[model samples]
Target: MTTTKPNMHAVAINPATWPRQTYFYYFTKIAPSGFSLTVNMDITATLAWTKAHHVKFNAVYLYLVSRLLTTHPEMRIGYLNDQLVTFDVLHPSYTILHANRTMANLWTTYDTDFETFYQHYLADQAEFSALPGPMPKTPQTPNLVNIGCLPGVHFSSYTPLPFKPLDSFFPIFQAGQFKKDADKTIMPLSITVNHATIDGDHLSRFFNELQSCWEQPTQYLA
Candidate 1:
């Protein structure tokens, strides 16, 4: 796919002011992932775009997600080491399944170009699968968001909570199996974010951006 440089900075943050400080106390008590929000979106266009272009769905998904996350810094803010910290460059870490049905974590940094990000994504999968039972929790850095795919099942809504704690600020995204809903091919996408750190407005904006980009793949993904 063709691409252009991103409008945001690659890796730099303004330490002078922390945008989410006001919600820190609330989030700390409510649990980052505890009182989180999950939204299921219709990504019919997303599936169509990847299939038409012969691009890996998850790879394209990670790229699109990274673009959105980088654009919204509030989603990337997390409480680490007892201090509120924002990442200069928050990458994506996804879960990959093995032949034995086990899962391993794989990570890839932010790459503005979809083709390059896809290449690195493939390499990371191969590199991680070759070795180890359960992969390490941490990837390239703490400034990484969690993204995964659940191609086997299609669900209306899902929460990655029971497994993760409430205070976990890292965002979790998963794409489910696509099914036909009348004439349109619809796919389920769930995004989980901390309630205290991020509000509904941020999520609404993300959905708006995603819908726009998916509707016009050639403009954004191409």
Candidate 2:
């Protein structure tokens, strides 16, 4: 974990000026569950990079995702204490799959350096792998983005439903196993974000930007 305290000064959203003011009330109170969207992404570069470097695909992809979230501030918005606040830095709180098929939820503070982040992640992964019990609760931090990967199967369109109504604006991202598709290699990904904070415009830019980075591993690795 990064000992450095996060410089996470946030600005409170003025509901009066908030664009979602009209629906925000119902979305937060009246609606049983907040709106969510899931899309399957093609991650050919992810597969290729993992094959060439012999590194775990999840670790490498997480690094890329951390970079993406760092650049996209809107993706960091979260509702806390009946108010909306945008975080300056968002960290990862994801599931670590153990060899025994059990998984534990863990959080690792994000680092700009991929190797540094991966090393800390691996350490936590090792610790969690040794202890098997009920799945740990993911920390409910405003600065933590929810992430998990499913290496078991690939589906065309899959949506992960939350246990309870999610009023928070933070993002949830999931990756599926990579498989061969004709002459191309592809991987599946799903992103669920609170509609209050993210819209079609945001998703358009986000998907394009992430895909660009994934397709050019060497560019980002530098």
Candidate 3:
């Protein structure tokens, strides 16, 4: 007995330009044990590359992720027993920004596959551009509620962990398969995850797959 809900949201507007890049954040209760999970992902080259290429890096990233979701149906997050459960989608807790900026990262979670997710992102992008007022509303899991945002927003800075043996490496955990880039040795990503579904082993796999995505590509290659 599964149910579906239609949630509409407003896009994040640039303080300087009004409507540019937008982001959404949601918190969910992990399934099985229902432990609360928080993870962050660092799209290190996300902004920089997009700006240089004059390509919508955010759009490309979103398209790739959306495609991943479709190829791997089990990766989506859903609702169960008043808790948010995911077979595929891994909902992160904190927003990943560049150099600890006040601005939020432009990432999102979806329930379907890559193609559908990509189309959805495009549709939303058009809506944001057409809207007369600032886009408002954000997605919240389990509850499926809309949240508010502030106007004239700007980003703040964040600091990575200081040099420490434990801080040397971070873990990556995902549902399907992926690879890493060979040219780049250190790929730094901030991941947000649920405590109930994964342990250290799962997180480790995610990083490995993330690297795989950049390295020997399976599907998501630019």
Query: Per-candidate TM vs. native?
Result: 0.80, 0.82, 0.40
Per residue, candidate 3 scores C-alpha lDDT tens digits across 59-116 of 4444444434333322343444533333333322122222333433222344345444
Local distance difference test values of all predictions, in order: 0.68, 0.71, 0.33
RMSD of 2: 3.0
Full-model lDDT, candidate 2: 0.71
lDDT of 1: 0.68
Expressed as tens digits, the lDDT of each residue in 25-87 for candidate 2 is: 665567534344455556777667777877777777778887898788778777556668767
Candidate 3: 10-residue stretch with minimal lDDT: 20-29
Error of 3 at 90 (Å): 6.9
Candidate 3 matches the true fold with a TM-score of: 0.40
For residues 1-222, write the lDDT of model 1, one tens digit per residue. 222222222333344565555566666655542333444555677778888888887887788888777778777766455455555556777787778888888777678777777877776665566565777433535666777788899887777646545444667788788778776766677887777667788888887888777667677677
Pairs with backbone N, CA or C atoms under 3 Å apart (clashes), candidate 1: 2-222, 31-166, 31-167, 32-166, 32-167, 33-166, 34-166
Using lDDT as the measure, which candidate wins?
Answer: 2
Q: How are the candidates ranked when ordered by lDDT, highest leading? A: 2, 1, 3
Which clashing pairs does model 2 show? none
